[model samples]
Target: MTTVNRSARGRKSLAALVCGALAAGGLAAAGVTTSLAPGAANASSHREAPLISGQPQYDNTDVYAFVSPDKPDTTTIVANWLPFEEPAGGPNFYRFAKDARYDIHIDSDGDAQGDLLYRWTFKDHVRNGDTFLHNTGPVTSLDDPDLNITQTYDIELLRLRNQHVISTTKIADDVPVAPSNVGKASMPDYAKLREQAIRQLPDGSTAFAGQADDPFFLDLRVFDLLYGGDLSEVGRDTLKGYNVNTIALQVPSDHIRQSVGQPVIGIWSTTHRRNASGHWTQVSRLGMPLVNEVVVPLNAKDRFNASSPWNDADFLPFVTKPELPKLIEAIYKIDAPQEPRNDLVSVFLTGVKDLNQPPNVRPAEALRLNTAIPPASEPKRLGVLDGDNAGFPNGRRLTDDVIDISLQVVEGELLGQKNDLGDAVNANDQPFGDAFPYVALPASGSNGPLAQGQGGGNRSQLEGGSAELTASAGDNGTLVTTSLVAAGAGIVLVGLGLAWWRMRRRDGAVL
Candidate 1:
């Protein structure tokens, strides 16, 4: 049966730090655990937003941008959705919404707003419905007839200025999402099918969508650590057996870069759903994993998701006097940075000064990357903090240990305070695959390594297929549909987009 670790140190200045109950102030002082977030192990943004918590498939989980290790001339930007997936998710498997719009925004010139938008829309197909199983027989390939649940998506890459679409082009179309890894017996050659899912776009870009091993690793026992627990107990990776839906893109380095002289670019992902007006509206978004989960107060989490980087300055109070640091000080007794943490503001809000920062840009939040910085030869997990400028906060690499790095920063290491902080679980359960879509293959639902004493059949693998996430979004049970899309995601966006394309073609306009 398929399943997954269920399982750090320090002391510091509480006197100078704000230690009282800080709910009114939106501060998550550690001792105040009532509404404080315990944080996921990977520093992931799973179900972090309030309204977004109500929508998982569209809930942006994590965003990673890096210079592709093998292809240094291209950059890989991966956006994940749906989380905590069990391998044995049968009956109805997890997937992207065929009608809803998913996006990856890049601020190339930086004023804290989008200069480029990569819009994704999916269309699914169901081959058979007589049986309760997703596959009638062993799945041999991505387009196999035995594969009942299949999906294809279109990527509309647009160049934007001042919040209006200036140029739009569908770079990729009909790209298939990889099939679920059911079991070895059912899918003997899973690697080949994964290869099939990785396709080349007309514009010399590469696209991949489907399940992959959850790349972020963290020792989640930090919940216990808040109460003074020993760091030794923090070695287990709680997210070990889970899988998530991923949309990975590899674009030529020059094409992805925005400004002329500046090599740095800011990136983030957002998901939009069709509302009553039949127009897609932003529902969820994420950049820094632990930001909304830790920094944004519980009340404003959803609003934060809906807002843009331009208006991020409105949330400055939360950043400068962050609640997460207060909690670390109150509970863990660690000395957090003093008010006005320019370091954090630089790292999270704006791009790091002179490194990834774009001049004249607003103080907006995004994961910035300096494309000129090549991938490190022997990468360091601690990233820039460890003298490896090629890793996270520069542009996240799969191997970067963001948890430990963030832990060190919040613990006042940036201020010259010393601490031997580490979660102990230094690596992913399975090392990353050395390929275009670097994420590991999706875990099989059947034949999980069922270690002793771990059994519970009630768990559903289609985790976000619930009223909160997909209530109006439409639900497709075991039944199959002839329509390219199944549920509440209206095709109005597709209709308008296609209409625009046809108009362009008819007018003989230069694309």
Candidate 2:
């Protein structure tokens, strides 16, 4: 069937699962579960590593982990930054944080301790010019051109082997840079410009720093409304018409891991800055767990973002905790006729392991992969859920259908049992490159509203109609039109009552 239909089918199956679960318990007679997850009740509505939530511009949105298809023993790590950078935001242009320190940590042993670290930092150069054209403008002679706002960054590689400090390199204009999204003729071979930014390390490892298309696709509006809002339609409504800033690094397997037998590694990224107090503050942190805090629970989300592999002991209990099933039970207001059945804890949680066999670590939130598992040259988008063990939770790639996979696993699809929910997942286009500097989405004109290109065209034809939702801006800047607050005074009253109730509870009164 078509990709759009497939995705729709997946959503219907998930909704069915919720309905079936509620029906079985007679909970459908009460109410639907629509309350927002406590963790999503923060200012920076998007997920970012804990410390970096304060800095929305540079908050690391997602970290991707995958084994390089071309090379064995090599891992590809991608960290995305500056969510929703409008192409029209001109003049100063987007740049990596200068004072911010970025890093990736690796752990060879399953205990989750870093055995190697890769770090990067940036320096800014502000030169004066006649007209400060941020992204696009007319080109002219540079005999005495102003050089205001030029920047360079440096990278460092540290090996825990013998506690040794290994390689260092500086990246500047000498390195190839991706051209801004002007016209193809004006920015002819922009991809080629991006290629220049890839540098070879002293250890022969490859690293790239530049902009690329955002790989994340989700119907975020549906999710926002799904959690305690008036709007109630659900189908995939992801950002099909936008892009994001990206910094990606690829390293040789041996360079990152010792000859030691274990193939597992602990990974995390950080952005740092010196506050007015002069102490360096870590703005963000992310590793193999992959948006665990954001998807898991609120009380644990911040701690998940702030802690490291070495200090995971402080947060492991929260990471491994099975709260969803309990939350589901509570929200559905179902009391067990006999004893409670926390199905989530029994099956999914207990099944996750660090290694393939004996002495396996209990299931946890981190994405665990066995390097010994050869990479699949031709990856199927269905991923591990399709019984193809090489995809997601094994180290996610952009093409993996995580939503469906998560749904299936949560609905007992992995236990060789048929879920009344049917197939709970689907994927969109399964196209991606197979080499270093993977292909990115093509640029579009920012002079008007962003368009979805061919993807939208195909979707429109398949739906046999056109989508009415469009983009709009509120006091908080650009937001989707569907995100506009619902009209009516009833919602206002409920909101005020909630506020007072919260205040009363904070004052230690029983509600």
Which candidate ranks first by lDDT, i.e. highest? Answer: 1
Pairs in steric clash, model 1: 1-448, 2-448, 8-231, 30-327, 87-445, 88-445, 473-488
TM-score of each: 0.79, 0.66
Poorest 10 consecutive residues by lDDT, candidate 2:
1-10
Q: Please provide the root mean square deviation of candidate 1 (C-alpha atoms, Å).
A: 16.2
Q: Encode model 1's per-residue lDDT on 1-511: one tens digit a residue.
A: 0000000001111111111112313433443222211222323676664444434466677889999989999999998887766666555668887758989988887787788899989998888767777887888888789888788989998988789999999888788889778877678888999999999988899999888887878766665644235455677776777778999999998997764488899888887766544555666677765677667777676567777778787788887888777777776677777778877888787777777887886787788899988899899999998889999789788888887887777666777886768777788888797888999887776534221112332122222333332111125343223232443245777788899999999999998
Mark the regions of model 1 whose C-alpha exceeds 4 Å error after superposition.
1-43, 224-233, 447-511
Residue 420, model 1, lDDT: 64
Residue-wise lDDT of candidate 2 within 170-250, one digit each (tens)?
432233334344433234455555656667766667777655655655435423523334324334424333345566777
